[model samples]
Structure formats: C-alpha cells, structure tokens
Target: MSFGLFQREQRSLFGEILDWMLTPLLLLWPLSLALTWFVAQGIASKPFDRALEFNLQALTQFVVGQNGQVSFNLNAQARDLLRADDSDLVYYQVLDSRSQLISGEPDFPPPRDFETPEPGRVLLRDDLVRGDEVRVAYTWLARPDPERLVLMQVAETKGKRSTLAAEIIKGVMVPQFVILPLAVLLVWLALVRGIRPLNELEQRIRARKPDDLSPIEESAIPQEVAPLVSSINDLLARLTASLTTQRRFLADAAHQLKTPLAGLRMQAELAQRETDPVEIRGSLQQIARSSARATHTVNQLLALARAETTGRTLPSARIDLARLVRGVVQESVPRALEHGIDLGFEGPDHMPDDCLMDGNPILLQEMVRNLVDNAINYSGRGGVVTARVLLDPFSGVQILQVEDNGPGIPENEREFVLQPFYRALGTNVDGSGLGLAIVQEIAQQHGATVLMEDAHTDRSQRGLRAAVRFMPKTPRQE
Candidate 1:
C-alpha cells in the first residue's frame, strides 16, 4: 500500500535540496532556448537586410535616363562584391512602374504593397523560387524621369541564413547550459550545509535515555530553530514533573500499605490468642478499621491516577460551578455525618446568572471532594465545614471557599503541604497526602487559582480555609 505525503519515507536532506534547485533550472532551459532563437533570428536578418539595401542603392546609381529612355547598368567589381560568399545562390530582379520586369528573371513577382511602407523601405519576405525556399528583401526606387520608377528585389536561399542563425543560437545557449548545472550544484551544497544543525539536533535526541526528560541545550541552536527547540524543552520539563510525581506516588503507596498490613497481622495474632469473646471481637474490629483505611487510601490513589489521565480524549466544556459544588457536598455528606461534622453547601440555589466556566466536570468534582473531605477529616465533631461559592461583582472572580473550624496549618508550612505525599505533623488521620496535590493539579487544568489561608475569627485562634478562585468569564457591568 502506498502512503500519503506525510507518511512517505523521508528523503535525504541533500536529495530534497537538489530537487528544488534543479527544478527551476530545468524549467528555464526551454524558455532560454526560445529567447535565444528569437534574438538569433533578429541578429542574422538585420545584416542581411542591410546588405540587400546596399545592393539596391548600388543598382539605383547605375540607372540613367538617355534620350528620355530608362536603362540599367552594372560594373564587374559591383557584381563580384555581391557574390562575396558561396554558402547559397543569390538572385536579384528589377521591375518598372508598369508591373513588368525590366531586367533580371522574368518569373520574379513584383513587390506587394506593404500596409505602411515608408520611402526607402527595405523589408524581408519568404518565397519559393525554382522549387527552393528563399529569404527576399524588396525596396522601391525613384528616378528623375517621372515615368521611370523602379523596384529592386534581392533574394537568397534559406540554407545560408539558417546556418548563420544556428551558429548564433549555439554560441548563446551552450554557455548557459553549462552554467545552470553548476549553479544548481552549488545550491544543493549550500542546502546541505544549512540543514546540518537539524541533523545534529535529531542525533542528540536519539542518544538520550528514555527516562531523560532534561531540557535540550539552547546555546548552540540556530536562531531560526530556537522556537522549536524551546517548545520541545517545555514538553520535556512537563514530562519530568509528571515522572517525579509518579515516583512520589509509588513511594507513598508502599509506605501507606506497609503500616496497614502490619497492623492487620498484629490484630490477627491477638485475636487468635484472646481468651474473652469481647477481646477477640475488639481485635477483629480494629483489623476491620485498619483494612477500611487501607482500602480508602488505595481508592484515593486510583482516583488521583484517573484524574490525571482523564480528559486526554475529551475536551473541557462549560460547567455549572454551583451545581458541581452541591453535588460534591452531597456525595461527601454521609462521611461528614459519620464524624458528626456539619457539611453544608452555601451558594446560589442555581448557579448565579452568567456564571459558567470551561472545565471537565468529573475532575472538577474530584477537586471539590478532596478539598471538602480534607476539611471533614481534619475538623473535630460538631465543627462547621462551610462550602461557599461566591461571585464577586467588583473583581469579576468566582470563588469556592471551604472553611473549617479546625486547627489551621502554620504559615511557613502551607506551601510545603501542597507537595505530593506531604503530611502535616501530628495529624493521626489516615490519608495518602495526595488530596491537596490533586486539588492543585485539577485547579491548574481548569485555569483556576488555589490559595490556602488561616481563617481567623477572634484575631487569635486560627482555622483552616482553602479557596479556589475561578476567573470570571466576562467583565462585570458598571
């Protein structure tokens, strides 16, 4: 099967260069030939025409009127002068004003009336004479005797004229034929020299390790190629970041899985040796809780992976922010009730008029769930976890704020907490620590901004507050 242009095997850089260089050169050859032929014909015909006019003038001088009668005369030297070359036979004729031949061949026809013939006009015409093709020149002559007007005609065979024209054409075209190929060769060489850097770049990429996501060096790259290299470097930087995140996730999963498996083993041993039924039941219960936490951690890790890979084949679309927030709160309410934490959605019943954003709904929901779940897990029983979506009129920003009355993070440690697998100190809660990182990634994908701050009420006590601000779709009216 034949491949399309894009899928075809790549041509050598040199070959591609040669094709472009030679194409125009080849195309111009025919044009050059045509132009050369035109110029050659003009050059050959001009002198011939001048020679015929000179012969006509010489014959005019020989005309004399004696006793009121016209006659023609020619000298031996003039005849010899006219027969200068032996390349082709020459013929001449003179006719009187009565359209009758006065001298030379009787079969020669009189000159036709030219549309705009001027005095002393000399023009070339083609004719068949004695079964041979000839080039002819004609001119009108005037004598002092009013009734003695004469027309002088000169003719030569085509062989001599054609030979002269061929010689001129060859001289002009032969040099160009040689020079054009040389120019094409030079152009091919220059193109090869120009494309060397691209080949070097390809070689550099091929030599790298599969896991090497380092940026390509831009110092030696040509200015024309710098943008392409910069784009590749940007992609490499993102891939490096992704690989680093994956490594951290793997390490965190191993650490998190080890603790639960060990606890389960210990619980099983205790249950096997227990004497009282209540003690055995308590050990089994502890094992079940540890198992549940382990399962939950596994599920979160899977969810994070899905969130990362989602939207690869799908495009973001307009999502209703208020509805998405409510849905997330509703799903997490059962968990919130288990801890007796108050989970409520505080936003417009319907999305505020004209409040919409381009986003992937599933990922957005995951982002909201992670933020609210973190608040619920951190806050104590009877603590208020308020999920608020507000559209600010002045700034034209849509804000989703989840504020919990739990001990807030220290200011210095807030930024560090966003790193994958980073857990706050002294928190006994079970989590993979990927919640905030996932929140940050999802927010970034939607072009939103995430900020963490201390929600202080009494100017002394600090509470946790995480806000994701979505930039407004349109400017607010005055």
Candidate 2:
C-alpha cells in the first residue's frame, strides 16, 4: 500500500519513515519483474519470426499454378535447415485456399482467435500443435487479379523462448533479491545509530539520584529534543524555588517558636514559685500570652507553606473580593474596638459587588486578614485604620489597601517588614512579626504586587499604606 503524508502517524519515528521508504519498493518489485519478462519474450521472438517469414517466401516462390493446382518444392536441404534448432522442435505446413494441405505437417493446428492477414504480410501468434505449446508465424501468398492465394505457416516449440525469458528475469531480479535484505539491514542499523543518543539521554536520567532535580544538559541533545529538555529545566527551576521556600519556612518557624516556648516555660516556672494569688495570676497571664504567640507563629508558618505549595498545583475560581473582605473586616472589628482604632471598610459595599479576582478563596481570605490584622496591631490607640478594595478605571487594576495612621515603618526598614520574624525597630506592637511575611507570600501566589508607602493625604502626617494590585487577567467590559 502507498503511504500518504497526512495519514495518522505513529509515535515511532523510525517505523514511520521506514514504512514510507520500503513499502513502495516492495510493491513495485513484482511489476518490474513482469515488464522484464515481456521485454525478454519480444527479444527472443524477433529473429526467429523473421527466419520463419524468409522460409515461407522461399516456399511460395516454388509454387507453380500453371496447371491450375498448387505445388510445393521445399527441398530436403531447406527442410533440414528449418528443423536444425537444437533447443526446440520445428514444424511447417502449406495449404491452398480450399483448406487442403499441400505439403508438410498434416497435424499442425491453426491459430486460435485468428483473423485473415493481407496477402504477403507475415503474422505471428501462439498455438498448440499436436498437444505441444508452440509459436507460429504465417503469411498469405496471392498471385494477382483472380486472387490465387497460398498459406505458408511455421511453428516452433517454446523451450528456447522460455529459456531466454528465464535468463532475462534472472539478470534483472537476482541483484534486487540480494540487495533488498541488505538495504533493510542498512536502514535498521542507521535507525539504531540515529536513536542511540536518545537512549543515552534516558540512561543518564535513569542513572541520576531521586533527589537530583537539577536541569538536564542541553548542549549534547539534538535540536528536536532540545525543547523537551528546556521544559524539564523550567520545571526543575520552579521546583527548586518551591523547595527553597519550604526549607526557609521550616528554619524560620523553628527559630520563631523557640523564643515563645522558652518564655512560656519561664512564666510557668515563675507561676509555680509564686504563693501570692496576684503574683501567680500575673505569671499565668504571661504564660497564656506566650503560648498564644507561639500558636500564632505556627499558624503563619503553615499559611506560608500552603501559599508556596498550592500556587503551582491548585486551580482557582472567580472570588468575590468584596464579599471576602467584608467577612474579614467584621471579624477584626472587636480587635479594632479593643485597640481604640477606627477599623473600617472603604469602596463599594455589599449591595453592588466590586473587586472580582481570580484566586483560591481560602488563601486570599488569609491574605486579606493578615493585612488588616497587621494594620490594627500597629495602629496605636485612637488611630484610624482603613481597609479598601479599589479598582482603577483607567488601568483596570484591582487593589486591596490597608492603611493606618500610626508610627509607620521607616523607608529602609520597609523591605525587612516582609521578611519572616522581622519587626521594625522600636515598635511596641504585640505580634509574632509574621503577618506581613504571610501577606507577601499569599500576594505572590495570587499574581499581585505589594507596595508599602506613607499613607498620608498631607506630608505632615505619617502612616503606612500597604497596597496589593491585582493585575487584570481578562479584558474589562465598559
């Protein structure tokens, strides 16, 4: 069968290409053999047919019709020469227009599917004479006006023709019979050699340690496989980043937990020593506070871990930021009241929704809560803290902002605020210092950028504005 370029292709590159090349060669081989046989038969018959025609002309010249009867005078020498073929038996016949044999073989069969030939024109065909396959050539000899015609026919067995055809077929087909298998062997060897590099690459990969998430080398890889290697490298790089984040989180968590647990043990010991109810009560309160701080720090570490891990594997859906932020604000209201800080939600309220973002809602809620909690914790008594979800009309950016009119972080220390366990100098806030770090991690997971700046309508006032701008993923409708 012929191969089409657009047919359903196979995964095996070697097999696909070999099929295209080999199928046509095998299909056409038999046709080539048949054509060669036909050519050989034509070559074998040419001289023999001409010799028969010459003998017929000689026999026709001997015919004397002056007595109104045909006479054949083919001498013994001419008959011996005609029958001299060593490889094939020869026969001849001469007949008059009345269908009576004038001389020669009486048992020679006439041609099947016969048509009368023009006078003096020779014709050749195959026939069975005396139950033997033979080739025949004949001519009709006419003697002018009244059309006195004589038929001279010669027949020869097919042994010589069969032998010559066999020779020609052998000459044309023997080399192909030998070369076809050799060609297949060469093609197979070439395929094996060409695919060896890929096998080597697979072996190299299999030989590597399980922990070896490093990139595969590209310099030695073929151009066709380079893209696959590059993609693997990209995945490795992302995995390295994720692994690094986990390691850092675990280390920071251990360090953060140590201080709070130590304080709790010290406070517990002091409470045991105190006999007075008031002193013991104070020690117990300190122990409770330390335990709470440790718990808070542990929870923050876990949140950061989830942010880093889920970013790559999780599927997100459309989250209503306005609704999520509203819940977070309501939960923080008591804490805001206790701090004597005015914590309020700004932007469009629960009626007509705003700030729709594509993200994991659980992670996003934690992010919003962290930002608001950080603001309230630092915004001393009687300070104003505003939480907002704003959308820019021109840029179509969805922004979540937490601003507080409190003692803000200095310009240089702003960068450190996002680092785990890092607090601004001289801050009297009661916190584990993981809020901003958690906020930064979650913002990264959501494809948003965080910015810290002075939150002041006038330069005279000092505070901080923490804004997270969510870039647009789809075109905004007017």
Candidate 3:
C-alpha cells in the first residue's frame, strides 16, 4: 500500500511543509532496502566464486592424458578436502573428449554445449546437483589431439553466502528505523520555529482595540510577508478617512437642522399665545414654512448621502443621456413656470448614438434634477434657464450643460460652491446648498467632470453655465 503526501485539503502551512519533507524520506526507505539487498548479494558471492574456481583448477591435476585418452585419479587428501564441509555437500565431475563421465557424482550436470572449448578458461554458473541447488565452476583442459578436450568441474551448496548476505542486509537496514522518526521530529520543530513570526503578527492584530485604524509595522515583518502588511496598512488608511468623513457629515447635518427646528418651536408657542384669528393664522403659516424648510434640508441631506454611498455599489447600464435629461427637464417644468423662468431643453429631438453612456440611471436622474432645480431657484423671474445635452463632434464626448442668465457666481467662488452646505453670498434663494455637491458626487461616480464657467464671454452678461463632461466609453464598454 502507498500513501500520498498531500492526501487532504491543505489547511495548515505547517502540516503541508512537514508532509512534503517527510513523505520522500518515508517512501524511499523501502527502495533503499531493495538496493542494499542487491548490493549485499553481489558482495557475498565474490569470495565463494573465487574458491570454487580454485577447486576446479585443483581437480584438473587428476585428469591425465594417457595414450590420447583422458582418465581421472584423485588422491585420498584431495577426496577428504572435497568432503570436509559439514554445513553443505560438495561435488565434482570429470569428462573426457567422448562426452563420458570419468568419475565422481555421475548425476552432475554437463557444461553448456554451445561453449567453444578453450584450453584453460574457468566459467561459473548455478545448476542442480543431485536435486540440490549449487554453484558450479568448470573449465576445458587441452588434450594431445587438437579437436579433443577434457572438462573439469566443481560445485558447492549456498549456505555460507546466504548467511553473509542476511548479515549485510541487517547491518544496513536496522538503524534507518530509528533515524526516520528522529528526522520527522526535527522537521516539525523547524517548521514551528520558522512560522513563529506569523503567529506573533496574528496576536498583535487580535490585541488591537476596535477603533484602532493605525497601520501595521512593515519593517518588522518578514520580507515575504511585507506585501501583505502594506496592503493592510492601505486598507486601514481608507477606513480611517471614511470614519472621519462620517463624523463631520453628522456634525454638519445637526447644525444645519437646528435653525428650522428652533423656528418651528418659536412659531408654535406664538400661535398658542395669540388670541386674534388673523394673528393665529399668520403664526400657523410661519410654522408651516419652517417645517417645509426643515423637510427640504433633510431631503437634501439624504440625497447627498445616497449619492456618496449607493453610487459606488449600484450596477450601471447604458442610458440615453439626452432622453434622461429631457425627462428631468419636463418634470421640473411646473417648478420653472412657478418661478416665472423659461426652462427649455436644447438638444436633438431624439437620443443620439454618442449620447448613450453607462451609468446608474437613478443617480444620474438625481444629478440632473439637482442641476435643474438649482438653476430654477437661483434664476429670478423673467430669467432664462437652458438645459442641453450635446455630443462634441470632434471628441465624441457627451456633455450636459445647464445655463442660467442670473446672478452668476464669482470666478473666485466657483470651486467653493461644489462643496456641501456652501451657498453663494447675495443670493436670496432658499436652498440647502447641497445641490451642486450632489451633482459633483454623482459625476465622479459616472467618470464625468463638472465645470462651472460663465455662460457668455461678455462680463456684463454674467451667467453661470454648469457643464458635466462624460468621458467617451472604451471599445470594451461599447
């Protein structure tokens, strides 16, 4: 059976590293044993094979060439030498040129027939002698006749070689069992020490207070982990800025709502104290006006907040800029007529191809409505307010412009008017001062730029023109 190194989901870095390190060591252990066994077998065979060759050469002395015929004659000392081993049986055979067995162990196998009969070369092979496996060493001896030769052979059982090979394998394999476990232990300890710094970083983050938006220290972290720390620091900075903006927005909203709330309280108390019907009606009317002003301020605050928050997350689609603007202008016609100002849309009768853009339609509508409403409020009676959507023929950039012939903002104050709750001086308009701010936020969300400039070149006919330039869509967007 085999086991995989990474058999499950890698949930821990430590486990993963340990598995990679130890799996190879464990898997190669068996392979190492196999290779050691092969080497040991070869080591055990060399001396035994040399001894067999020596005995075969010794037996050659007994083969005599008498009158062109071979005969074997062994002395008592040589016979006792062959039979001396108690652990294993030894055997020998002598064959003359006629393929006749001359003496000793008649069942001993012959040499391979295909071998060219050389004069005095010894060869070794494994064969069965009397049904027992034995190692054989044989040689061809030259006779007087050129084509005839005598064969001498000796063989022995494999008891000593088998014992020596077993000893070698035991010596090589016994220590690995103990060393493998120690190696695994050392690798585990090293990985734990290597990842100690990451654990320390985690503890530091966990100890931080809920309101702590400070950056993490990058210099103390490992070089490999420094990029992760830098990204965390960037996120912390953005979160701090967002929190600060929310605090300031809440403070300003409270301050702006105070005056209308105070007026409502004052008018209610005055109406309660008045006895005359006409005076009571006048107090009630003042109270109604204060409530309306408060309502308008609250609505503007909500719109500005929505533009900042929702515009970032809302999915956008291709919208017809001209048609959207025309619809907003048409909706504001009643308000324009009430103010006695001419509210007219100047653009193509139908939506043009270039006028199509990708934007959140609800946010775009709020932006255009704010522009039109702001113009109607600031432009007094008999003033002309023109809202137009035009496509620049050369650049293909779509533009929405609202021009009003009224008391325009001074060149120095143009940038300041785009900020929330900043109303221009000498304007009697009742506004929450958030219209242009909403316009700016919405324009940023849709990748457009807002510019405030004079409607006419002549300084005497000073009128404000607020233009939103929508950047041309890329090929992918198209």
- Which consecutive 10 residues in model 1 have the weakest lDDT in total? 1-10
Could you give candidate 1's per-residue lDDT for residues 200-237 as a string of tens digits? Answer: 99999999999788899999888999999999999888
Q: Which scores greater on lDDT, model 1 or model 3?
A: 3
Task: Write the candidate numbers in order of decreasing lDDT.
Answer: 3, 2, 1
Expressed as tens digits, the lDDT of each residue in 1-478 for candidate 2 is 2263425544566667777767777777788888888998898777777776676666667655655777777677666747747788878888887779998898877655558658878788888988888888887877432376777788888887788778888887899899989997898788889888899999999999988998999999989989999999999999998788778867877888999999999999998898999999999899889989888888887877677666667778878777788889999999999989998999766423344667888888899999988888888889999999887766668888999988888889899999888889898777777888888988887789889999986778979999998987777677
Error of 3 at 14 (Å): 2.2
Between 2 and 3, whose TM-score is larger? 3
Candidate 2 Cα outliers beyond 4 Å, as residue runs:
1-142, 145-159, 167-181, 199-238, 269-279, 349-357, 392-395, 419-421
Candidate with best lDDT: 3
Lowest-scoring 10 consecutive residues by lDDT in candidate 3?
A: 1-10
Better of 1 and 2 by TM-score: 1
**Counted clashes in each candidate structure:** 0, 0, 0
Task: In candidate 2, list every pair of residues with a backbone clash.
Answer: none
Question: Estimated TM-score per prediction?
Answer: 0.84, 0.75, 0.85
Candidate 2 positional error at 361, Å: 2.3
